[model samples]
Target chain A: MNDHSTPILASQGTPCLLVDEERMERNIARLRDRLRAAEVAFRPHLKTAKSWEVSRLLMTTPQGPATVSTLREAEELAAHGVKDITYAVGISPDKLTRVQKLRAGGIALTILLDSVEQALAVAKASDPKDPIPVLIELDCDGHRSGVKPQDATLLAAIAQALAPRARLEGVLTHAGESYEARGSEALSAAAEQERAAAVMAAETLRAKGWPCPVVSVGSTPTAFSAQSYAGVTEVRAGVFVFFDLVQAGIGICTQDDIALSVLTTVIGHQREKGWTIVDAGWTALSCDRGTATQNVDQGYGLVCDLEGRPITNLIVTIVNQEHGIVAARQGTPRSDQEFPIGTRLRILPSHACATATQHDRYHVIGAGQSDVTAVWPRFTGW
Target chain B: MNDHSTPILASQGTPCLLVDEERMERNIARLRDRLRAAEVAFRPHLKTAKSWEVSRLLMTTPQGPATVSTLREAEELAAHGVKDITYAVGISPDKLTRVQKLRAGGIALTILLDSVEQALAVAKASDPKDPIPVLIELDCDGHRSGVKPQDATLLAAIAQALAPRARLEGVLTHAGESYEARGSEALSAAAEQERAAAVMAAETLRAKGWPCPVVSVGSTPTAFSAQSYAGVTEVRAGVFVFFDLVQAGIGICTQDDIALSVLTTVIGHQREKGWTIVDAGWTALSCDRGTATQNVDQGYGLVCDLEGRPITNLIVTIVNQEHGIVAARQGTPRSDQEFPIGTRLRILPSHACATATQHDRYHVIGAGQSDVTAVWPRFTGW
Candidate 1:
């Protein structure tokens, strides 16, 4: 970042993707070791850390398993020689072809579907050569997907209908709402609630004589705080790979633990409007509109310097598709002084998963944030 | 979309890119004919229309000309036989390797650089065998890149510095701020302002004895407007190919003209919270903060039916990386009567480019909305 002769490509360009490689390596090691100590299989969600370079670290571990929200990630990760992947999104009758194509190519693929209708559709359409193995989703957080744990009859119906043709591998749940917690204290409690609910559904399925191997409970907040695994066999969490402002706001992870950021340049100052325009717009930093009532209302994200510290109360308050408005952190934006145009800065994403998808590569930054060690290119596609 | 069992390999998933083949064809035809009538070269910006399929259409217009924002696009377009490309993004010294690689790969590439330091960097790093040509970017609206027109002395100095080792081709300016205008009237004024600024810059550069060939002024909103194209040689607007909510919000395009939207599902509901959860989250819709202001706060996007019609004012209100919250359009979300889970809905993207990055394919919905036509796939890479 010093007398690098030209603008540090790392310090220049707007709409840039920055990864704290050191922090990422630590997160990877922690997750791998924690699961090993607990004697449970670990599958890091590739959706958060989209970079194959970061994801490659997992292959060195025992259960180099991974999870994805789209078929694109499956194809990309598969090409990278990291095979074990679970397409975590609910399966529709249509995506079965993409799923089949992945499985046919020799990638161990697992999918999730909740309703009996969807399961039946997938089972009916699945090829005879490679039938689909599905994890019946269970709703623990009351946030999304999965039937209620109390609806044992409905759960049995879905499993029964899907079991004949499709393999009912396990039950999966995500306490996504755990991200709404105020602190580790609340997050720990949310974790317990997530575990208990998922376990209850697993027990209900067990009582009905179903083979639910993967009693999954996932969410960055819950995954970090859950003291008990109980009936869970596998977990499916995504955001832990690159904790964001939202996660830190909820106390799931500290600001120091956050790893991903959007690199931007100070473009111009609208002194009249009191707005600081940066090159990183909604296009570079994603539009994860998660300004919870409690969390810091970072317009889009917190603007930080190269050392990774917030620049005053400055937060990107408004953003167009390719334009962002940075304002004073304390009050309204004051475009009084001019930072040299093209000054490099980083904007931490509100949600890691959303921001990671926008960029195809990551200029991995490391070496105590002073000097970048290497530029590792990652893949994103189906 | 239909009961067609062919697995059209598309027509499913939220945050999906829909190709308004008709509107696109029209937009393309109109731009070509209008530019021809104006007697100005039309070097369409590929940044807005990133599809090779779309680029090919522009190249086929006999102009055989185009502009690119990323080296990846230039390489891809070159592979597709598109030799003439202007790399619009301001390059840092580090990108010298990429520029060299592209030049050797046989791409007729011209890049943009503003200062003498960059010109010197390029001259020093570039292979003597493949000296680069540069477009001295001009600041038209004081939006993003380029030297100020009034600073003719500085422009001449940089141009002369790069002239020995590099060909100073022309001046290009993107009236990106045109999108900030509300209607055609505002766009017209912005267009005139942009044209006047570009002309003045060219006049100043010419007076300094620099033969700038490409005098350009463009933004999709002003592409069709702006009567005075004096001294302007070409247009470099991009977003006209794939219109979105931002365009519609600016009254440049109608909602019916929007070609892309994500098809989602009503996953669950929080009755007490007055919200309905949709499968389309920020990952699909993109966290593109907003445009102009937070006024059109389509959290993730506007939820519409499969056929494409807004559902109440119930903006996607809030979104997580992969989860969207839909509420009552008129008032608060009233999930009193349980919305039978597993309902399919479409959420129009706030910006087509950002949202399209999250997906792998475009499910071309037929005119009837739900009828499946053909599937168009896109490739993303550096």
Candidate 2:
């Protein structure tokens, strides 16, 4: 951890995002391998690593069966020749125009909805020649948006509403509550609940003489913990590409598996308060205290050495816009001798997706080396 | 509050940032008038609205006496012909090259430092012919960074380090802790402490026969609440250009004064749970739960109507990466009839600075009108 001679990061600006490519590829491969072994299609969510360069690695093919949170991501991926994509968030009427545009451009873009109102809107927007493929989102664990799996009336109503104008491609559900799962047992249970909910909905649609070809169910924790995909055609997970403290806390990935880190310099110090102020604050690191609810709360982010190894007991305790106060986790004394002014350090993020979006580009550290291999551009906004 | 006929926002995509120009102008004028009446120079921090268009309105002149947190802000403002800028964050050694580059390009760019290590780095990086004008940062309260006003030895040491190579321009301090102040009395006390610390530090340097010309002190709360600026050469404040919920909670600005909002579309609803899901989740509306500690926690943000009026008792309670769960505060029942699918709602930010950085562009509602007159682009990163 004391070996701070990172030539690539040393030359770069103090507050910048660094992606360990070796670790990133390993993380991506781990999830891909798991899903491949499970004999299910892996539709990797591009929301985490919003780079085409990263997306190319995550996708099974250039023309993807990918998942996206935003239409911007769908558009960007489509531009990169990704043809098959699922717009994962609930479809709003206003957003359907962009979805239709993407679909018209020969991208097999899919939209998700859980209500009859949304179904009717999708039906209204669809072309007679090429009806829009839709997914009925099911609420697995009362997490967020979705129709209940057992709501047969609502399920039949939504499918019937979409009948002639739109195509009911499948049913999808996300186990967002799986983030709260502590152990493998809890995670497995959450995954099963998600899978069962998704499959049940798909069955209901099929039983009612409706097309429900795809059964998608996932979340980073649940995807890894799922004992079986069962009837699910494809599995989707976003944060698995760059596992963070939240996923690490969920016991999915360890701190070492976290590919993203903010490269920062020790700007100044408050020796009396044992605070080593760094140039990277909430602006660079993001205000995601995802680990606060976990067993070991990583204040803002866990502090690491330049080589991307954790500095024992050190974390970002406080943050202003551009100033992060790095201190020992348990009020232990830290000194200038350990982290003096101009000392380069890396901070492992609390939430990878949140932190990754803060930066425009990623300085990718070469496979198993300290040298920066390449810089990948990231885009944001709706 | 019920008027939802906004042609501009309706045509535009959901989850875009909207800046009320009339309210913004008023917010900016309030601070400018206050500082001007106090007979002190105002160096408005361009960190809040990082747009050249916005900066032009905030600046007193084309060649600005502006404040910036990052070198990127300084560089961008410089490109817009801003000459006099103070980079307020503590200078890191690696960042000095860029600082020097800016100074060499005819920018009277001032860098701040609180330690001898930084002063030495500044001194080393300084061109003996045109030394970097440096400010010795003083910690007014036990806030973030700075040399303590009472720590004369360290102050003298820093000044001594900059003696021949770097020019000691002045002293600066920001009462970042002022945001924690509740009422006018507490705000005034925080302001006085910030002013006293800067003046006291300037006096200490002067007593040692060192030139300390520019004694700058301010924070949004302190800038407005400070009764006197007797010894201070200039006052610097950001976040006043677009007041937020946090500022409202601090009693510095009323909720009516806030200018920034996130325009989101109601995508779906969890009716039984009284949750209205919106497209603007943490990704669009930042993961900044800044109002959580306030007396009345505004969750993610306070929900407003399309015409930028607050909806009674509504707040965004939970957020996923791309979905926000807006519910009535205190778990009051909110039906789909109240907020149907495709209903465009504007969310007032919890922290303007944090929320504004989440987007790249602002859809500006023209002065006292609903139409978006212009689109202002915002830049971010180190």
Candidate 3:
């Protein structure tokens, strides 16, 4: 193994995910500090930076709980000593055995349930002596799954079904529609709606004498935009640890704040089209046009220099499975001379979660240095 | 270890890739038979199904060569006894060392070079006694990389730069623009252009007495649409093993020919919005919206039943990192009851290359059986 103190990039291969350690730390600190200031417990979602190294730095509370999208992530984190984890996606009956295994391993695992059928499935699958803990999913923005917060009848039925073998923990809401927000005002509105919906669901459950202890609400946009987290016990958000072009486009964070980028090398060029072909294609950068609906359409991703400075007027125009076409934004002269074969560059992703999933590990560049200081493996698949 | 003859999917978890053995074999046979009829050597590109099992079945010539996008793939295939492998991507100076290592391992590795700079870099890196074999990449259609085939001066200059340290082996071109072809007429036109351009480049090289021994031309659409391969020696195409929605939309293959799909389970639903939430999201299915530009806009992917039959009017409308929203197409009535919680479904991807990269292994379903007979691992990364 290479020395951790050595510059990591110097010994690394191209077309690898590069996490700026300082920027990532700063991004984590900003969110943690903000949530702390709001006096709400923060559960950093592990769905974005699926790395133990990054998760270690993200922990504000020692051995604290977190949110995960898949059981695989929960199992990995649990093996690494993370105690509490909420499998954020709605529960499927088939996964009950795996969840039981995770719980048996001493993980304080909580599952998400929105329907009575799911609650019954979990209750039936659970051991009566060791009841499974679950949070009721509330639909805040109707962007995806979940029961509406106002559907008290359905919520009560689900709670009743989980009585002996499962425990009704609280309610969770994700303002995924907040991603469609065009401005701060819209984002703030969506945040408030998300907060209100989760708080309302918790209140309705408590009014009915149900123990709704934890009211969770958040999304990366709402986590930063919410004016208050009043009745919520914990806020959950991912992607802020590595701000992407989508977040930057919506003014969630500046382009400079993006901590994750793909380190690539210029391999060839198409002179007539004024395109500089790079090794980081859709396979490396990902085919996430997250910013396409935003104010500025970052075709594939924003082009940056080796040091992560934005190359003005340059963007990845098109991409194949293994080839990225970098060219001027519009009406700008080509700079083929500036980016000859073997020239290294960094590409800020349109969506951090999408782009990061394409790679197996990250070549972490420490603050104020081009060398890779560390390498962190990330797990993928369900 | 699990028995290879056992039903693989019966014990496997959800949200995993499922490859239909029969369809895949038939697809492979069709391509090989067509190429054989055309009298051109078939060299399948391993960028799609990066599984050694698939490559084994793809070999028309015993222990024959294939094309790869990355050196890592070349190395892996070489280890598995694929002798004459071609690293299809344009060469970078840094990769020359790895190429040399592969060559030393008795693999007749051919690298791609489109510039004089790359030629000189290879020549400088190679040992005088064992020159590196290279193919000059020609720009047939201004879709991506390569030097224009008509530019004989630049080609001659590159050949001169190689000298004794590097050998100019042949010429190759991929009509990636064939992806834009909407109908048979357009596809046939693109194929002709692809064939004509590649042959012209080979003829140009041979006219200059450069001993151009090989001429390769292909793309999935062109491979099937081309009327003749006249002067081409070999044809290369990936994505044929697992046809996808994009290929179907381009009229290359019917949806029935698609062999790869994601096995998912319905976790929850939004009744009012007519949406059924699935466990497979962008992470499992990939974020490739390849069919978005085609005549049919398959949102994330086309939703199919457990038997891999298309569920009429049902499509994955949106996707989160680990959740997919399955809904009815426009003008179709909602059918949430038809797809309840825990109901297993198959999702046909928009692009096989993009989708296959998301999974670590394939759950191989045998011919005419829903049960999986084998599990094959696929490798990824540059």
Q: Which candidate number would show the highest DockQ if scored against the true structure?
A: 2
In terms of lDDT, model 2 sits at: 0.89
How is the predicted docking of candidate 2 categorized under the CAPRI scheme? high
Best candidate according to TM-score: 2
Q: Please state the error at residue B97 of candidate 1 in Å.
A: 5.5
Quote the positional error of residue A106 for candidate 2 in Å: 0.5
lDDT of each: 0.72, 0.89, 0.88
Residue-wise C-alpha lDDT for candidate 1, range B1-382, written one tens digit per residue: 4242234323454445667566677777777788888888788877755677767766545325888766677777777777678887666665667777777878778887777767777777766566787887777786656677777887888887886677778777778778777766888899988888778877888888888877877888888787768888888767767777777777777777777777776655555567777677766676664453624555556777655777766667776655678876444544344444556677777777777767667666665565557676665543
| Fnat values, candidates in order | 0.26, 0.89, 0.82
TM-score of 3: 0.97
The complex in candidate 2 yields a DockQ of 0.88
Candidate 2 lDDT, B162-280, residue by residue in tens? 97999999999999999889999999999999999999999999999998999999899999999889999999988989999999998888999999999889998888888889998
* Cα lDDT tens digits for candidate 3, B93-191: 988889999989898999998999889999999888899999999889988888798999998898889987889899999999999998889999999
Residue pairs that clash (backbone atoms under 3 angstroms), model 3: A7-A371, A7-A372, A8-A371, A8-A372, A9-A371, A9-A372, B8-B372
| lDDT for B369 (candidate 2) | 47
TM-scores for chain B, listed for all candidates: 0.89, 0.97, 0.96
Residue A179 lDDT in candidate 3: 88
Order of models, best TM-score first: 2, 3, 1
